[model samples]
Target: MASNSEQKIPTMSRQAAEALIAEKMGPDRVPRKFKIITDTSDFFRVDYNDVVILGDNPYWVKRYEKEGRFGLDDEPKYWVRRAIDLSDGSTKILKLVFHEEFETKIGGISIRCFRSPKKEARILDLVAEHPNFMHGHWVLDSAGNNVRILEFIPGPRYDQLIIDYGTDHQDYFFNYFKEVLDQYIELVTAIKFLHDHGEKHGDIRRDHIIHDRECKVNRWIDFDYNYMHGESMFGFDLQGLGNILIFLTGRGDVLVPELYQQQREVFDRLWGEDLNISYKNRVANLQKIFPYIPKSLNRILLHFSIGAKIFYETTDQMLFDLAKARADVIKLSGRTS
Candidate 1:
């Protein structure tokens, strides 16, 4: 790791930072505009004008500040920029590291979580040649902090596509449904390959999967989340996967707002227990609401329901059911409704 004790991070005054962060986490207060710090040094020249500031997700910035890790700069040191690699003139993602901490519950399991850039760097090396993962190189910046130089994949994020086409549920269902399911299988299979190699994606949001338009494949990004799952090592990720399945299969959630558009009979007939256990508020009962969704696939979703007695422990196990659902649903989807 290179050292640049001389390279100072921009930060807010302790009192000011405390107040600003309090507003960020507070229930009632609206936050004021704050400066976002940008890093543009080293072997790569960051496009300073285009830098994007992504804050510590689990809210560890406050602690880092309390510990004097972020002493008196205008903002947090962690940020990303599109940079031109001075050596080869190739553009790459320059990701600055900032440690974070938090906790979340998945399937009744308490999982302690934090940033693990080293693990992500190692996985980047592991998937350097793999098509489904973004190619990246890790280096220590002049400040002795880890920096990831990533090959940027160009395309819409998976989540955006879901949200877009899913507006017309029937059209999305008939035209894109099978293809989405197939792509999801490929994604999970890629994840299973990582698990087989004794690694975890750690974070698995729908947005993390980017559809590489030129290559026509979904590429996974941002694997920095490292968590402590008690019994099932990949429990948190599995929950995320299940959530994605719910979103994809249902062709978007039919929540309270959408319910107003439906017949009063339709709205009144549904019950809370019929909704997904993990995401109760925003979505509805797919099996009941959309009876066209095959039971084969609907049964698989039940594991994430309130009445579930078992949860998927592994990607391979989830894939087994997915394969079965794929076969049944594809066959059922062929018929006239």
Candidate 2:
């Protein structure tokens, strides 16, 4: 027999919890744009136990310090947690940007730079039609803080997929490589859609690209660093894509240490010498290091990496070349089959 205190207690499942929250937070009160959380306090409750306070709270600061969580400094800026709507039982990811005051040489100033969440919301709105981007659900405000809720995407990071499938499996490398290349092409297509609409995803990295294997969908997230329309923004993103391709090809530092080390030395010597000269030298070094890359694909990668031949002046050009490369691979596969 178990003691009364040791008896198991039933807990609500996530669905039941969300349903209860939704009932509390009336659907009528939910706004299309961001509103302060305090404004809707009558319908929602904050669970303090599971919250991540990003502001300058001494208690939280000390707690995070004891836990050895990185990025907690003397001055912090945001708080993040999950909240439930009492009326409808819907759960939302909440972010709170704090208000601050500073003293400068001239005088005292109050700064409310809580616009990042709003900016992200706006970007999401712009690219809402595209399935590859995350959707912004709502924005709320309370007191002097701003809150943003985004649709949560569930998947593994692009790099994680490479790690799980790329190592200790030379026989499957080609298949995996083709799959990655196909995904990369789709990413390029999505980025092109953004460019066509006059927007730029400033950050493009392996971690930012999430792929749902079951659904066969790729979502690009973390638009906190996104940029507005600019003539050169497309080129900047293209360069990032080139770097991502290099990473996915298993030629990065972790996968091929000796080759990366050699490339690093060359890159170090040419650092800041001249942008064009350095890019050209690095691409040339990569060609020598990763000779397994198909010649056609190598040329396409070089166009983006070096920008000397101007083979990919636009996203369309790159996509066309990629299609051709895929077709060539298919033909070769058929011959072997």
Worst 10 residues of 1 by lDDT: 58-67
TM per candidate comes to 0.73, 0.61
Winning model by TM-score: 1
| Candidate 1 segments whose C-alpha is farther than 4 A from its true place | 1-78, 105-110, 260-263, 335-337
- Score each candidate by Cα lDDT: 0.66, 0.49
* lDDT (10s digit) by residue, model 2, range 91-173: 44454443323321101222112225555555777777777876554433333233455554567666667766655434234
- List runs of model 2 lying over 4 Å from the truth: 1-47, 50-91, 97-115, 143-146, 166-173, 227-231, 251-257, 260-287, 304-313, 332-337
lDDT of 1 by residue, 1-337 (tens): 2222334443334345434445544434323433333333432333232222221111111111111111353343335555433233345666667577887665455678888778878899888778888877776543456766677788877767876774576777766788788889988898888888988889787767889998988999888879876778887778778888888887666675567576566667667666677666544357676777777788778777766678899998999999988887678658422
